[model samples]
Target: MNTPQQTESIKNLVENIDKGNIVLPEFQRDFVWEIKKTCELFDSIVRDIFIGSIIYGKPTFEITVREIDTRPRKGQGSRRKLKITSFDKGEINQKSQISNFRLILDGQQRATSFYRALKGIDEIWFIAKSEDDLDNEIKTKEYKDRSLEEMLYTFSLQEDEERISIKLSEAYEISKGDMFDEDIKENFFDNLLFVVAMNDAELKDNFRRYKTLCMKLGELFKSELLLSYYLLNMDNEKFALFFERSNSKGIQLNFIDILAAKLYKGFNLRDKIDELESRYPNFKFDREIIVRTISYIVSNGKDIDRNYILSNLNYDHFNLYWDDICKYYNQVLDFLFQEDLAISQNWMPYENMVIPLIIFLRESNQNDFSQMNEWQYEFIKYWYWASILSQRYSSGSNEAILQDSNVLKSIAKGIKITDRVFFTRLKSQIDSYEDIFSYSRKVNVIYKGILNLINYNSMGLTDWNNSSKLSFSKKLEDHHIFPKEYIKQQFKNDEQAISLMDCVANRTLIPKITNIKVGKKKPSRYMTELKASNEKLDSTLKEHLVPTEIVEGLYDEFFNEFIEERAKLIFDLIKKTIIEKEKQIIDQYYLAPRVQGNIKIFATYYSKKLEATLDVDSQKVLLLGESHSVSSAADKAKYTLSGKGDTSTNGWRFWKYIDNNGQERYIDEFRK
Candidate 1:
């Protein structure tokens, strides 16, 4: 058993395992050898495909060891497929090679599965028309990525003599429930076509398949699991290191997967996860979210620390509070959908964003959004947008969420939440961003979040008819301000110009109709028409909060200026949007909410050529003699500047507007 052989014949290995020469190390997990997985290995062995190799670690020092669970546990419901469960730990009387016993550091599960098949303890069989079909299947078996009850078959191994040739009828009988009654299994053939032509040669050919496959597969079965062994003889001090190194090269079990196993015994995490997934037929969450949710709840809403997530907590409490976990999770889903947090799953930049909210809900005993105050809603709203613009949860496990999870517990309790902080730490992190182009991969989620904000801002945008608030059902695609087609024509040789088309400043979410109708047209041309036709069109466009830097009679030659100008303007617009969103977010969101009158302010500059003062409230310049938005206000103000105004005079950029305190400030200050 201590022999350091690189390879062993399949027959010899199986026999040795049956005789208890090979044993699993104490560190190994129990045989959770799935039936379908075993069958898959059987199929590959039949094709003589190299499934994989195994590692056996033998200790140089004497160590006590017990025989592995070759036999099934007698009364355990999950172990029915296993044989001879009646063996006892005391019967560990099998001298078991004592210290010289080889421990399967890797491939223990696989080896045991193949061993069962060869010993006729658990017969694994597959149906194929010929050896060629088996060969073709092994080469293309990646499609069976899910559970095992696939093209292979499994039957009871009552006796070794009958193990190789299983009757189709008996295979069906021995299988539990209607397990063999799958649609694929419906084509189970006494003949290849599944059409029974009694006495037909083709039909007779089908009957030979099981026996033929069994005989051929049985020959390779030993060799398949009989893979080359990487044997190491290490002392106890290095055994663990060698075992880890030996298994590290292969697919390692995920920490989360191990966590699921570490939960209370008999806690069917898989079945529970399936139930939760099926609960939302339309929106299924991934397992990590649920696992984190459980961790948050079990810890009483503190933090989803990795160590806690991977350990088994009190089962009594788990059993007691299980329903509450489901309640909090479902409530989380409902809240996200209610808020329209995501246009679709793709728009959801970070699933981790929901962790803090759900943790608060679970800890606060608050299951519904009704418990959320206006301030909380506003805070959450701001947090959501801030998260996107700042990419707050971009990292897998952000400390902010964990930090917020603790703060949320207090806030959820109707405790007057302190404005001591929010996004301040993120400010420097955010400032580090030199620029975010529309084309940046990181900006995609942020852009989508911006789109949602635009559509929802101030009663949303008007539909094509200008009849009603746009419906959420309609998709708003990223629109180029200076159309890419038109821009391409302007800078034909500049590839960077094309790449800059994705700039966040240049991109805005607009109605498909607006996006299409405005296609391939210079902004000054089409927009002038649009500004003239609809009295509310200016406001509608402004509602978008994008930098609308257009004025009449400036274009064809202004393409480069458009990008540079729009880039600055759009950046300013983002700052302004963040300002407004900050108000909705929390107290720390830009020094609490700054409320202003509905009246729009225009930026007015003094005309040095004339000593004239314009009344700001009228939305008019005395020189212009009419009401105007900020842009028009600037036009008149510029005229007063030098008895003339050039195309360079941008009113939006020019005017200094009053804040809530009635103190005048430039639009540029907010951009800071």
Candidate 2:
């Protein structure tokens, strides 16, 4: 076995530019450092604080970095030599002289950040604070209230043909909203007039603060930046292993990142996720779902720990099924939309639910649920609400998934499920309308779920503005029933006041235009504005699920009574909607027991062909005494006729009619 070589070396900003030996690998992500962080990094370096280490692999051949995406070039790969060159903003450049390169396995971000700041790429600077002035600032609390750049002298050394001009500047624009009464720049350079050119005869004193700051900055540049590096021999496999483990302190390496490095494809898994995510812009594709999904099917319902998942996975296993996973998972997304479960992947309360969902859907019946029965739909609904209302996936997530995956697998195989504990537990929960802030501007799972329930149930809000369509998703803003001011007046403690003011029961999504008109008014006062017709206000209130009778004279009732009564009303509304609407969805859309005695049509090269007789009650089509579901029957006919599956054949074209002397058609139509 060949042992890997490891070592450490220090390199300064000048050496990095002059040699250009350190370069990032193609696997490294793009640089995203902002100007503020650049300032902090430069300050840490000048104060001699340790930033961290960089790891490098000494390869046989140096590879150029992918061209950085920026305004100069719009995300295009660069063919340039990719070496850093030394050039002052106003002066000529010097080319690098060294040849041997170190492929950066880690710390590419830190290096790029340093390069940008040192090169003044984004106009970041180091604060040149003297020891005495720094102490004075700390004592006066100047450092506390003001930015480092504002309280102290900051300079950038710009060199021309002859001498370096030490220019004074302020970083107030880049400062994080910290302003000082006194302008540090006013008469800042007064003492430094020709201080560099002054002889001993013309010098006022060499101890002037600005002169000392310039001297410190000039000396600081010559010193090397501290960077600890592990020097590894050229090996792609070893480099990948090190890179995956390198980010243990931060966000650990995702399976996609490791898989990409292992697979070495033209486009990475992230790009594929991006492509899938683009197809459904409203939904966020959780990377863990992708990994867990692949793991679930590959393991055949067995559970795997997060850390060991990548180790067990091989390139062949992923490549073979990745494309199918992408397609089938998209169908899963479409299924979610069809179900109306109040799920937004972006604001999902329990994203863990999606893992088992995709796995079960992908595992069952040719990786789709289009031919599903009524019981399957009911099971899916129960699975969704059970996972949501109960904390089934929140704790012991691995154990829960393992158990749930087994149950779902059994169901998909047409096995009878007698167990009902999970669904029963979810249904038994009496505590609904849990407290969530109305003051929140962000869309959370609870709020989004509430809105989804309303929309799915088709219960439109009663409003003064007349409109045919209820565009609630865009039109609604969260409205507080009890104004914050009223709540504040009711409670002596400020914190207690806000708790009642922002609670979920006190809020509802109403039209934004109405919200603007109502603007901070008490709910009692605005109640009249919500009534559109002569219908009693209480009747309208039931439609919106507002606790009108309780909130009408809410001032009379104590705050606690108000909360309790409104919470009960909200709970009842949710319970009624979910329980009743589910039956409606099943009764109207259930296709398992589809209507029978209809003529079935199939697409052909010349014309239509009758394939099978529909027996909707049995949920099967009979062809030559062979039973098949609607779609499968059509597939069988097309395949037997042409040796191909014409999946595009419209199965819904089945028609029932008395025709001109109508008798049963299907197989008889071909005889005609």
Candidate 3:
């Protein structure tokens, strides 16, 4: 229960560093440090200790001593004292205590060299030995020149004279027979200490002090010994914190940090996601999207509250999500790689499209999204985020929207639907289905916003460099369709007339070269040139819209008709798609459904602002309408004054009614 403090001395600790005795904990890394780094570490320690440079500033290292039953040699068993040193919180005790107690935690190369050199193997030798033996073979710089010293330093040996009698295991010489050459030994030791000194000084001065310590130690110790502190003595909460804070130099750790430690041996998670995403270069989502998608799949598509889902996800539950990790990975594969759903000619609004992908996966019998289930909510999420940011910066570019995690989170929470209605105060006139149909067809401003972009850019400009520019295939550059000169020419002396040309609806993109080519031309002339040089257009225009041939046939009259007809068509298409999607959502989910009937309908007294419902089929000629249809009764209505039945009947009249909470109340004067 007591908090652990860093152990101070190599003699006071009691962990066995026997190769067989050392056990790597499930949470620790495998023994991955190489000979070069190990050597450098030892050199840094000796240089600092002897040169009095406390390169590693804060007394961060500690070693403890422990006694264990010595191996039963050919003769007998004895209690041997083990010297275990703590470096970077990992304990590396002496495998078998060498006799004299001159411990070097940082300079492992020098210590290892001393042990090997003294064994007196005839085939292997060191530089600067006190006495030379002709029988001891030393490596030469060249076969002709044998001047390189093959002995440990004269000063080092003298300094350790008193502590020099320790006997190294006989196995050392047997393993390194004839392999220890002078150049190899020198280069290895020099690099080891250089890194240690650099690491030590860097840690003390930097913000990443804790992380540097862990990296240095993980490099120095084998996992079997390192795991003792991280797993045996550490609590889960504390361990999670430690693991997160211990990432390498440049990595910014997150929930995926812990997962890395857990899955390092089996899967390369980041690489897997990166490779998968390369397939969908158009794909856009933060790290959280991947985590959430897997969580949803693993939970069997449980409709968990949005907030709860994110909070509960962690490395521990990763196994729960593992079942679908492969599936999600593969589906991402299908969408990105196999389907080639790149952002070349098609622009799918991800906010509304990504959701469908998840629904596809959840409802399908197959592990991946079913072939029948089109890209759903997940795909919409991707498109929506991209579009939201793209639309936000239609005029300019700022990463403010891109970096705002909150906006992305809002996207994740999704659209919050309600049952509020429009026609609540109703004394109806024509309460019939046919009347409702007439009302549904009315054009509204809401429809305008949705369709105008397509009409002006997609349809009207089809003959004028008409590409799949409608898809927003690349970075959006708002183009001025009726360039400034045209606006001035069309409206000779009106300030407000030219101002309308700057609206977002008029701005669309063309290939920069094409835009420049068509510069300053009349809309008709621009259309003609664009039609002639069709090579520079998008390949998928036909798929997203009607035939290019049809667009060509109507090119002369398209821009004019586009202002009146195509815009409305686009708006209607948007409305129909939205309504159908909403209904699909309600049918597939919406656990509770309630109806309210205490409502009435009212019509506006003047102006062309038609109420949410009321038939305008027989009426004609009017101003603009509502932003969009609102009534629970009829989808839309318009006010007009020219056709057969306009001013003759009240322009504002209710045909049928439904309440604010989705309850129908058909007009029945007979019942009253």
Candidate 4:
């Protein structure tokens, strides 16, 4: 039997492959063909098979070869696919109709080898009539000979009837001839052949065997096991849908979603209150406590308004007493987790308390609680509520027990054992309460109390002692009480001697030199000077002090009324100091300014002239009397910038005084 021409046979096999008529599953990874390896493989086959002129079917093969497709299908689990395309019988016809020939699967390597061999050259290798040694049917006396004869008969027979008995194998073995290099056995021959293929059944039975072979040879010869396909291959809509499905991981989880999930998972509350809380993210923090407490409260069919219960209690109360509540929660969660405790609703009752309670439990150092007092526990609870409700009223971690002494004092005053018990009881008392209302009221109370303590005037103006080596007299200062501008405004109505003299309310004990420098500048402009002078002041106060820390702490508002109240307090203190100073002078000397009223007589001289001048009335007084009479207009009281006493006619002779009460007095005559 004469097989068809090799070209016609190979053409039929190529057609079969293109039409998907032949299914070749990948037995290794996808085509990783290096151009260099392909070149080498091509050169080897040409040198060994074509050049040697040995008919391909004869054994004693030193090199091995195989062929497998490298493309992958979508969703196939393996990383490699394999197919057979050639055999030992003959080369395939490249143009023959594949449907007409019974393709013996073993020749895939041979066909590929022959095709690549012929493709690189201008002429294809053909068996010549001159190589007559193996052309005749010479019988060898062995069973191997019979098997070889049987195999050859399958392809040699020209008639279909004679080919029927040949048992065709699905794989082929080929020789390296003299082309096998020891170093290239694994790197070249084994990789290109045996490692390239394993049928599906063969792979399942012996994946270890082929995987090891691939490991030794190289990955290039292995078929693609994992199938990967891109959405771009599909139509627009399918492409979009596929992309969306693949790109689902792109959406970022927001903080709330992430935090909520953590709370839900860590405590196993998915079916419990977390499910309900998921419906409204805004109420998550409040629901952290309310839902579980409500579930626990309502389990026994008690009629209570959820809103009313939350409204009366306030977050402060909860913060102070959440631990006690969690003790009850732990019982509930432990029961739920272990025994599936009977809950009021099909709702997972355990979740409500576990999330926040577990959070608290983990936050609290268990061993240290033994030494903690009731007050400490209450303080911790208050801070917790403060953090959860107002998003942290005091500084530090959300769970830190407030260590600031002032904060501790403020919170301690607000939360008492009585208030704690009452709110807990109130949880059961009210028909409906809002968590937000309770939370707001609690925060408002705490914030207001803190503000009050900060603004309290018990420290008084004396606290501005500047004991830290700070001094207004030297450092430059201004009155914070009633500014000079305010005095000027009031001065518009009253310019009388008393009114023009700065009013008691207008007085402020400040750095003296600075006050003198500022003089009558508008308070707004002077304020900039004052702020610039005080580097120790907080930057917020660098522009304005009255509305800064002092006023911000002292008054809820810095409007006129509040300013007036602070002014009154300040002026009262100033007036008392001025009165005491006047009394001291009066008790010391009758000639000095009287503590009786705001008046004092003083003497002066103008060059050679004598005059008794009434100098401006200030906190300080200077008095002088002279011999000049009331009727003497010639010497109309010339005043001199003289000190306590003058040597010109003795200091008293230069000035005279007529008392306001009609008492006439001369300086020298009175002294005599």
Tens digits of per-residue lDDT for model 4, 125-228: 11111101122233222222322212221111011210111111101111212333344344333432222332343223223322222232222112221122
Clashes of each: 9, 0, 49, 70
Candidate 2 per-residue C-alpha lDDT over 1-672 given as tens digits, one digit per residue, 9 for 90 to 100:
164533342225335534555555565775655334554455445434455666656654334444222221111221123433333322211212244445567766666665554444444434343222243334334222434333333322221111112332222221212433233223333233333333332233322333444444544444455453445652333344455445766866644576666555543666767787787665566666666667776776554545445566665666676777776666776666555454234434566666666656665756577777776676776556545544344334664676566556555655543323223333413344433222133334344555445444544444433433334234556666665666666564645445556666666656667667766555666555555433366754555556666436664335556655666665565667454455553343223322345444333321334445655445456776788755466557656654554333223223222222122222212211
lDDT of 3 by residue, 29-112 (tens): 222222222222333222221211111112224434321223221112211222333333323324223211223234232223
Ranking by lDDT: 1, 2, 3, 4
Candidate 1, 270-327: lDDT as tens digits: 7777776677555566666666666665665544645455444544545565656666
The predicted structure with the larger lDDT, 3 or 4, is: 3
Return model 2's CA RMSD, one decimal.
Answer: 29.8
Candidate lDDT (C-alpha), each: 0.51, 0.48, 0.32, 0.30
Best by lDDT: 1
CA displacement after TM-score superposition, residue 641 of candidate 4 (Å): 88
What lDDT score is found at residue 423 in candidate 2?
33
Looking at candidate 1, the ten consecutive residues that score lowest on lDDT are 155-164
- Candidate 4 lDDT (Cα, 0 to 1): 0.30
